[model samples]
Target: MATLDGNLVSADDLLPLALTNLGHFTSMRVDADGSIRGLALHMERLVKDCKAVWGADLDTGRIREYVRQGLDGQSAPCVVRVTVYDPKVDMGHPADADEPHVMVSVRGAGAMPPQPLRAMSIPYERDLPEVKHVGLFGVLHARRAAQLAGFDDALFVGRDGHVSEGGTWNVGFVDESGTVVWPQAPVLPGVTMALLQQHAEHRIATVTVEQAKGMTAAFATNTSIGVRVITAIDETELPDDHPVLSQLRETYLSIPGETL
Candidate 1:
C-alpha cells in the first residue's frame, strides 16, 4: 500500500519525485501490533533529514498518521518507508517548491539472509554522508559492481583507506576481546546502530580496511535486517558465528518496540 498525506497515492502525485528525485526518506519495520523498534529515532531522522534537505519543518504527528493510514490496519509485520518530497517541485525550479509532502509506502517485512554476506570494499562516499537522502545512484552502482564481482554487498571505504559503512547498512566489528568496535567515519547514523550502542558495550575508532580484516568478526546493522553477520571482506574470511555477535543480535531483537 502507498499513501500521500494519508490518502491513496496517484501516479500524478509521484511525477515530481520520479522526475526530479529530490527527497529524503526513512524506513522502519512495523510489527503486527503497529509497533516499531527505535521508532523515535526513525521519526527524528525523518525530521532532521527533512530540514537538512528542504529547510522545512515536518510534523512528526502527521507523519505518524500517514504511516498508520498506509498500514491500513494490517495485522502482519511489514516494512514502511516514509519519503518527504514535494510534488509541486519541478526539476527546473526546485528552489520555489512548497513544503515537502509525506509519502508512506508499505510492503511485506524482510529477514536477514540465512547465509552470512561476503562484501568487497570499494572507495566511495555519499554526497551527504550524514543525511539519508534519495541520491542512490552511486550506492546502487557500487552494489551492482560488487555483485558482478562475486560478492554479496559493497562495503564503502574512503579514499583515505578508512572503512565507513556498507551499501545500505552500518558495519560494525567485534574485536578479539569481544568488544564491539564501530568505525569512526562520516556515515549515516543508523537507528539500529544507535539502539545497539545503547545496549552493547562498544567503542568508536577509525578503522581501515586492513584493520577490519584483522578483527575477529563483523556484522551489518539496519532497520530491516536488525543484525546480519559479515563473514568475509574482500578475500579475508572471518568467523560467521561469533558467540558475542550472536548474543548481540539476540539482544537487539529482544528489545521492546514502540508504537507508531
Candidate 2:
C-alpha cells in the first residue's frame, strides 16, 4: 500500500525514524492523470534538502520511480509524501549512513478546507528555515496551542513582531494598492510560492504583525491548499474578496502541471 525506495513496505517500518527525527521531506499532490505541479522544482527541493541534511546525493530518478510505484493502482489526484533519512547511526547522525533513501507514501487527496484561515502569531522561528524537514515539535506545538486558543492556525513572528510564515504555509498579503507583499524573513522557499512568483506580481517587504492590519487582503500558500484566503491574523481582518487575490488564484491555476 506504501513504497520505500520503490519497494513495498509496511507503515510500521517507518516508526524507527520517529525516534531520531533526522529526516527531510517534501509532500505534493498528483493530478487526476498522475501529473504533479512544479515537478522539477519538487525534485530539486528533495535533492537539495537531502544533500544539506545528510551530506549524501539523493537520486531524483529513483525518487521519481518510487513516486510512480506508490501512485500506481491507487486513486488519482492523490497526495504523495517523500521523506529522506538514514535509519542507522546514533547521535542521530544520519549523514553517516551508506546512502540516504526516500520513503514515498501515496494516499487519497484531502478536500481543501472550506473556511478561510484565522491565525495567531507566535514569537518563534524554525531551525534551518530553508529545508522542508520533519522536525516539527516546536511548530506543531505552536499550531496546537493556537487551535486550542480559538484560532485556526499559528503564524510565526520574530522577536521584532515581524511575521515570517505559517505553521505549514507561506503567508502573503495584498497592500492597499493591489500589490502582492510577501513578508521579508527567513522562510521555507515553498514550491507553491515559487511557482506563484513566476506567474504573479509580488514583492518582499519587512512587515510586522501590527503592519498586517493595514493590508487590504491576505492568503496562505502550500501544495495542498494552493492559494487560500486568510480572514484574520490575530485581530487584523483582511478583505475576503479582492481583485488581487482573484487574479493570483487564476494565475496559479493556469500553470500547467508536469508528470513525475
Candidate 3:
C-alpha cells in the first residue's frame, strides 16, 4: 500500500499525466528499527527540488509525518520512496505555478547482490542531472542495450569520452594515494553519494574512459546498493576488493542513521 498525502491510495494511481507527469523523488532503505541515513539531506533535496520543479514551498515536517504514515508501524527493513507531484494540476499550461503533494510508498527491501558488476561504457547523459526526477527513459534504454550486449549495466560516457555515472548510480574512483575521486561531469548528486561525501575526503576530477582503467579501484553508490566495487569497465578489469574499498565501506557504515 502507498500513502498519497496521508491518504491510502492504490499504486495504480501513480500513472503519468500531463500535469503530474513531472516528478521529483528519493529512494532510501529504512532499517528494521526505521532509522535512515542522511535524513536531513533527503528532506533538503525534496524542499529544493519542489521549489525548482513546482515553484511551491514544501512543508518537510508534514512530509515526514506522511512518510511515517506509510511505514504504518512495520518494524522490518523496507525500501521507501518519497515522490512529490500534483495529480490535479492544469496540464494545458504546465508553466503555471501549482502545488504538489507527497507520495510515500514502502516495500520489502532486498539485499545487495554480491557479484561485482561488469559495466560497458555508453555515450549518454541524463537531463537536469542535478534533480532526481522521474524522467528515466534514457537510462532504461541504455541499460537495456547494455544487457543485450552482455554487460550488467551501462556507465555513461560523455561525448568527449569522460566517465560520468551509471544508469542509476554514482561512480567514484580511488587513486593510489587512497583519495576518493569523483568524476567532474554533469551527473545527479545522489543521496548516498552525499552521505559519503559529507563523511569522507573526496576530490572532483575529470576522468576519461582510459584514465578510469588506470585507477586503483572504482565503485558505484546508490540508495538501493549502499556501495559496490566495479569489477570491470568496458574491457579494463578492476579489483572487486581492495583495502581502499573496504575502508570506503567502513566509512559509509560508520555514519550514524537518524531515527525515522
Name the weakest run of 10 consecutive residues (lDDT summed) in model 3.
11-20
Best by lDDT: 1
Report the C-alpha lDDT of model 3 over 51-147, residue by residue, as the tens digit: 8888899998898899888888765578899998877655676675377878898888767534578889999988888888988889999999999
Stretches of candidate 1 exceeding 4 Å from the true structure: 73-75, 112-114
Span of ten consecutive residues with least summed lDDT in model 2: 89-98
Best by TM-score: 1
* Tens-place lDDT digits, model 2, residues 48-147: 9977887878779888888888887888777899988775645544446656777888777766533688999888899999999999998999999999
lDDT values, one for every candidate? 0.91, 0.85, 0.85
* Candidate 3 Cα RMSD (Å): 1.9
Question: How high is each candidate's TM-score?
Answer: 0.97, 0.95, 0.93
Writing each residue's lDDT as its tens digit, candidate 1 over 1-260 gives: 68899888999999889888799999998876778999999999999998898998999999988887888776567889999998999788888886899999988876543368899999999999999988899999999999999999999999889999999999999998999999999999999999999999999999999999999999999988889999999999999878988888888988899986
Once fitted onto the true fold, the runs of candidate 3 whose alpha carbons sit more than 4 angstroms away are 16-20, 112-114
Question: Cα-based RMSD of the predictions, in order?
Answer: 1.2, 1.6, 1.9
